[model samples]
Target chain A: MDTPDTLRYTRSHEWATDPADGVVTVGITDFAQDQLGDVVFVELPKVGTKVKAGQAIAVIESVKTASDIYAPLDGEIVAVNEVLNGEPEAINAGPYEGGWLFRIEPTDPSAWNGLLEASAYEAVAQEG
Target chain B: MQRTPLYERHRDLGARLVDFAGWDMPIQYESGINQEHLAVRQDAGVFDVSHMGELRVRGAEAMAFLRYTTLNDVGRLRVGRGHYSMLPNESGGLVDDLYVYRDADDDFLVVANAGNVDTVLDALTAHAADFAVEIVDESDRWGLLALQGPAAAVRLERVAGMELTSLRKNATRDVDIGGLHVRVARTGYTGEDGFELFTAWDDTPAVWDLLIEDGALPCGLGARDTLRLEAGFPLYGHELTSTTNPLCTPFAWVVKDKPFFGRDAMWGAPCDQRLVGLKVTGRGIPRQGYTVLDADGTSVGMVTSGTLSPLTRESIAMAWIDSSLARDGTDLAVVVRAQAVPATVTTPPFYTP
Candidate 1:
């Protein structure tokens, strides 16, 4: 429910933030974590892997169900969140800050312009 | 979707509602499944099991009729006591796993799975033509609430204003709680000391509110599943399906030595597969429909139910495997998400109270 104004979100409920030069931090939105209660395992893609926009690069397994986390834009995975391997509950506790999934170096940084803004993403979250 | 009497309470409590067997029921509360599960293990948690079906059988031939239809020895159930039993299909498989409570000399109450109620009722009706028993569906008339945990008895006793030390396990008693007529039974699916309260549909909300005020945590089906699986209780759809025989599982004791509907077929049934427990020795959670493999990685069977036990903090599962490989400590692997995770064959009941 907390969609920060500085971040861009996708229809699939993932959020991307441009926090540094050419690198975009990616994590599932607060809405996604709430819907998928009590995450037990997070399968992240390896570093240096090339991923296309909308491609499923990771899996989030909760106690009740399992779901895929899609890449927000065409990019190369620069770093993965190894902390989630041991403590996946961080996603439930702090989905926006401590629960960031991975970082990617976008092939085209302008792809962020095409994603939904925080206010627009709020509409999608509300429609659900 | 059908709603229980406590549906509004669940909504107000911020429970996550899910469709279960055509009923809109709470799957988890705000505290989450793991927390709710531990609450039942360490303290008291109450569940709105109103979705469960209740059937009443009463007549001169009630005992005889039940004996012919069910797999257990109904004759052994004295008044005020109950026993776990199953309705066997003609092919030696199960119709449903249920609890038969002897309420009176000629009356019995059967608590059945919510999803299998109609099927079980039809089965009983078809089998009752030869007997003089009358089968009445009382599911709509009663709402069941299961208050389970180590502290369940103490908490329930305080609210009911009664002494529960004399109530034996698997026994039922009619009592008045806050001027509401209630039937308290010392039986539950979770392997814990607890009581299941059956009250009239209209009185359920009041009873639930009173118990919540008495410090009972509201639990949902999600925790109910983890608790039962940790206790190694077989679920009806997963472990005792119409195609799965009970003789091949640890529940064979329910099939007594006496003759029953499927006695002849089950006498020498070829039970090549046996239900066994698996403790994950490696990474990944074993889930239902996952393939079970042997040392050579050859497919042998499939997992029926699996979960990471909150109490033990270990991943455990129940699976059906080749009888030859069902021995304790037999090396096996489960295919979880296309990876072969090492596991070992162990006895069920991963947790004890």
Candidate 2:
């Protein structure tokens, strides 16, 4: 529901924020967190691991089910959020800020064009 | 296409609705399953259980009729008391698990799962054709609500205008709730001390509204699943089904001591697999239908119900495993998304508080 204008999203619900540096911080959208309520555990890929675009990299486990977190773009994992390992509820608390899953250096910065902008992602999320 | 009386109320509360056994029902509320589950465990939570069915059996031959149709003995049930039982088929499989409440000498109430209502009713009617008993389907005409938690007694006591100490576990009584005659049963599935109120169809909305104002948080089927699983209760479709036998499901205690329907067939039907609980030590959740393996990675069984426990903060699961490996403290593994997660084969109940 809280799709920020500066963030780009994928149909699978991962959000990517491009900083001034080449690295992009990634987390699941609020809509994604809401659908998978009360996250108890998160399986994050370790730093320095190479991931392919659209591949399953992590698992977000809620009380009811476990959902896969797909890679938004092919890249090498530069950093993983250490706070999530201790408090998985952080994903439910602030999915966009404190609940950021990982950071990566994209293979190609131009690959962001294929992702949906904020407005387009919000339209897809709102479509019943 | 089927909807309960609380359909509009759930939608207004921003519930996530899904089709559960042909009934359009709410699976979770705005507060979500974890919070709702905690509310029911710590405080009071209300659930719209109108989708469940209630069948009335009455006549001079009611007791004898039940003895022929169910696995539990109705002769042992006294007035104002109830007992949990199962109905099995000739192949030693379960038809459904239900609770029988003895209202009077010739009257009994059988509460069944929502999806098995028609099947159970038809079976009962066919079994009673040559008998003197009568079976009636009262599911649509009656609406049911479950108020569960430690604070449930406090809230319901004030509304019923009676002291709550009189009712014990598995007890029932008729009371006037907001000018409507209703039946209150002191029993629940959450393993917490609670009461289930049965009222007329038209009066349910007002009662639900009043109870919500009385500090009962609205919970849906999602919370119900987590709560019951944490309590180590077996669900109908998951832990039980027509293909699953009652003896192997670890519910043989619910079977009667005397002869009844499907008793001889299920006594020693050679159950190769037994229901056991699993505790995963990894980060991934174990889900239904996941392959379970041994140390050699040989397939031993499959998971029937799995989820992250909201109370224990662990991945808990119910699995049907080889009878030889169904012992507590035995190590096993579940293949979750191509990864083998280490787990232990424990008793059926993973948690008890």
Candidate 3:
């Protein structure tokens, strides 16, 4: 339930943070992973693919059901977490750290403005 | 929604509740499905299966009536024994899969699926005009609990104050637990050494508490589904449906050579498709309703039940496909999210303790 203030979130429960340079690291929120139960498979978009904001760029499948992971902002996919192919449970163990799905180089830096901050995202989580 | 007697206990234990067959039941407890599944496989786990339906038949022609109504030869069953059976419709399709127990020469008990209780009762009543038999719906009068695992007998023996050495598989006996009379049956869906306890509805909570206090982990329906899938057991709506013929599945042993309601139709049934087990050899988790394709990329079947088995850590599924292509080691593909994943036909179960 910890919504780190350093990251921005979306209504769809995805999180993005600029870990270094102009690249933003993207992953699902802890609340999202918890609701998904045990993660079994993750399908990530290929690198160099252009994605629009709010577009489904990844798929996270649990033992119970499958869910789509949306891109928070329009960007080109630069890299994806290859470790997820073998061990998707990292998302359940540490959604904020090792479970980052992909890296995106933003087309518009102002796209972050449209995303919700930690405080605002917490309200959405509560309402859900 | 209908609530079981242990609804309060489930809420207090922080179980995730969901609507199952019109009953408000726990889908998973606080520990989650994976842990609960492993608990049942390694140790002992208890399940609240009170949602299942119970029917009692008692009359001068009870044995004859049951033999003519069900797929199994009920006349072969002795007192204190039971076998898995099904109520087949006139067209060879299943009405419901059940376990019939012969309690005595003139008495019998039928345990049915929760969703098809009313349908099964109506069918049985409609067929009872010729025979002098009384079919009574006793679902609300009893509470059912299943204790499953390798250590189930040892754990239950401590709390129930009875020796379980005499009870073999599919055996039933009456025992006393904490001064309460209960019927214990050595049968379970998880393919483990286990026992199911049937007691008065009002006394279920106390017996459940006793089993938990004796080190039985309280499991939920989520784990139950996974466990049964791993065991390759056929569920009512998933594997055995109104259009599914039992003769075409791995459970054909339940059908006897004697006369029954659907015996004539089943003999003439066109069994073009047969149920087969698939082990995913490629990426993607195959699920129910997913398309099964042949090597030529032609649609041949559909998945009935599937899961990522916790024991094997491999994706496995059951599908109904062309009987000619249902052999072991047959190459196939499953369309998961529009991606064709490589799979191979294998005979279930996926795991064995």
User: Whose TM-score is greatest here?
Assistant: 1
B66-180, model 1: which lDDT tens digit per residue? 9999989889999999999999998888899999999998899999999999999999999899999999999999999999999998998899998985799999998888899
Per-residue CA lDDT of model 2 for B109-179, tens digit only, reads 99999999888888788789767998999898889999999899998987777787579899998887777
* Evaluation by TM-score, superior candidate among 1 and 2: 1
- Model 3: per-residue Cα lDDT over B44-151, one tens digit each: 999999999999998999998999999998899999999999999988899999999989988999999999999999989988998999999999998999999999
DockQ of each: 0.70, 0.73, 0.66
Query: Where does model 2 sit among the CAPRI classes?
Result: medium
What's candidate 1's i-RMS value? 0.9
Task: Provide the overall lDDT of each model, using Cα atoms, as 2-decimal numbers.
Answer: 0.92, 0.87, 0.92
lDDT of 3 at B126: 86
Q: What is the lDDT of candidate 2?
A: 0.87
- The candidate maximizing DockQ is 2
| Order of models, best lDDT first | 1, 3, 2
| Decoy 2 TM-score against native | 0.96
Candidate 1, residue B56: Cα displacement in angstroms equals 0.5
Q: CA lDDT of B323 in candidate 2? A: 91
Per-residue C-alpha lDDT of model 3 across residues A1-128, encoded as one tens digit per residue: 87899999999999999535788899999988877888888999999999999898789998888899898988899999999998999998899999989999999877787799999998999898
